[model samples]
Target: MITHTTQSVSKANIFLTCTDEKYYRDELIVEKNTVIRMISGEMKIILPDITYVIGAGDTIFFPRNDLAKVWKTGKDGRPYKSVAIYLTPEAMQQYAIKHHIKPIHPSPRTGIKCMAAHPLLDSLFNSLVPYFNLKNELPESLAEAKVDEAISILKLIDQEVFNTISNVEEPGKINLAEFMEKNFMFNMPMDKFGYLTGRSLTTFKRDFKKAFYTSPQKWLTQKRLALAHYQITEKKRRPVDVYLEVGFENLSHFSYAFKKQYGYAPSSI
Candidate 1:
């Protein structure tokens, strides 16, 4: 799994990605922005309630400050490829001024949404392919211009998408139970989940018990163990690989938990 931010090279938020396979990895997106172009391989982004399979040539626009769990896998051992351009506050402010687009507080209708393929978008992303191999970071001016070009395409792609990218994204105030069901695979601390769901930590735990009739930690253990067992036996994934993917911190603890749940060691299966 690659954990890199284009923030290192340019504050413009142009990041390059190359991956062979990624586990169920947790990530905190710094900006609620648009223009995720998948160039090659396969990518899956698991939001709290929705999931998307982003194959090569697919583009997705995500909400700002999204806490996501993702799975990225390659085709035939090749690296998965993509670019993410986040809408920096400065950029959004500038766009609103130049386009005479008002700052509207309209909330996005979906968790993470895909934009239909546009030839303009296709060409724009294609132009970025060579940057991945640059020995040094892209020049600051060039990176910002590329990001500008991407946003220009959004205005003509779809209105819904345009609004989603243009507006400042607020956290969704959603059903607690529904949120947990979709996000349980993430191995983050409880507070992170609570914050993402727009709840105080104490309120989150209380609501969690009311919905699950069980403690969050216990539920997470059982859920992860069950999935680990399924992967080990049915999918034939190695124990080493399954442990972290399902949220366990390490092998020894995962082994202990799996045995307690299934009455057998993971390797025994």
Candidate 2:
């Protein structure tokens, strides 16, 4: 079971220490304007468009009106432990608009591969752990000020670290052959798969081929066919079932792709 607390203030709402106890699957739902720090352990953020793996000593900020899910793997190789903080969209909107800051948007890809750390932003987030844990009587003005300070630090970091990447045109194709081999079992969207590793389709393909000398789509097809073959031969699952389960929308399409990649139709397996 997952345990957590939800608290609402005049201006913002927060969720602290939310996670599943068993450790196998843990998740936190974050609304807009939330700022999250990994107090300890490793956490992965899975979004519709991207995914990010946040380790200890890292902080992530979510601007207003975005939705996200955060997952943590287990400790002792058993289950994960985690804590989180949530802020309201209204509070963030008021502050950003009043201060003339462009609101933060959801990133298009996943992973920390592209983001560098800023010492100041890192320090500021580290300092907030105690307050987030305490959640005790804090002066509203002080609390608001602290949130604003965090936001300011994030803005500076964003300008320095994310602006250039965000503005650059994405590459045309991404190669996910190896990535698919490792993670294709998970039933996530293409964008989410791309995001979790912090690469847009174009960049993913470029880096993928550069690294593996193959294309992502082709790689994914090969992986699925291999998985299907394994399931048929070892797991005893039917070919049609495997095709649908591995994210194929159509059997004929799956067969065609399977044949193209493996030189044998899925049924032959």
Candidate 3:
């Protein structure tokens, strides 16, 4: 089993995440625009259309309201370590107003944004490493200052990323079928799916029925199970490996549902 740990600097949105195991994998529903600096080891981000790998000394950005599968791995006997700073809407708005910043042009990219090496980025993240050893929590004001400094450095180094982070547009109504088809494997609540696809709960269910000809719950389960079945049988993956990756919360439930759907347990495959 993987031993995962995270340390934070008080009320600041910054985080230091580590894992002792050789590899750790999980899913994320990013709630805020986030920048991560890889300190050691490597991280691979799997998106719907692409995958991004970040190594030590690499800086990458994840936009808000995106679903991704992240795989982290240790290297050369060292644990995986990274510093992640979430860019809050309030902070972005405040910085924009204070700096007289406006969106230059909308970015068409949906995948991870990678930036070239810069001294300011390196200096900021290096200074944060020692805070992990502190006994007392850092003050909120100091933490916010660090975040603000990062925002300023970003504006100077990468304007495209600066614009992407500064803009906080709500998701507009998009094609429900195309969206759901790509994102059905993520384990989110019905309402959250609705919100991300720009619909209310009532509208989500109604539109889901029209698009899938079935209830949301039923369609999601069937699709997840079908994908799991393919992975287990065709790809020769184990039941344990396939269950969580397919959105089932537990092994027993996944086994029960797999048996019900195919008239046999997943392990039998």
User: Best TM-score goes to which candidate?
Assistant: 3
lDDT of 3 by residue, 62-140 (tens): 8888898888888777778888888988898888788887755556644568879999999999988888787778778
Q: TM-score each candidate.
A: 0.73, 0.45, 0.87
Q: Order of candidates by TM-score, top first?
A: 3, 1, 2
| RMSD to the hidden true structure, all candidates | 4.4, 10.3, 2.5
Winner of 1 and 2 under lDDT: 1
Among all candidates shown, the one with the greatest lDDT: 3
The parts of candidate 1 lying over 4 Å away from their true place are 1-11, 19-31, 44-55, 65-68, 73-78, 130-142, 209-214, 226-245
lDDT of 2 by residue, 140-252 (tens): 67667766665566557665323322222322333455545556545555565566456775666577777667776666676677777788779987777667555565789
Error of 3 at 138 (Å): 3.0
* Candidate 3 deviant stretches above 4 angstroms: 2-11, 21-25, 103-109
What is residue 130's positional error in candidate 1, in angstroms? 4.5
Q: Give the TM-score of candidate 2.
A: 0.45
Query: Candidate 3: minimum summed lDDT over ten consecutive residues — where?
Result: 2-11
For candidate 1, write residues 56-164 as lDDT tens digits. Answer: 8889877665656667777655567777887666787777787787786776444477778889988887787777668787788887788777777877777776676
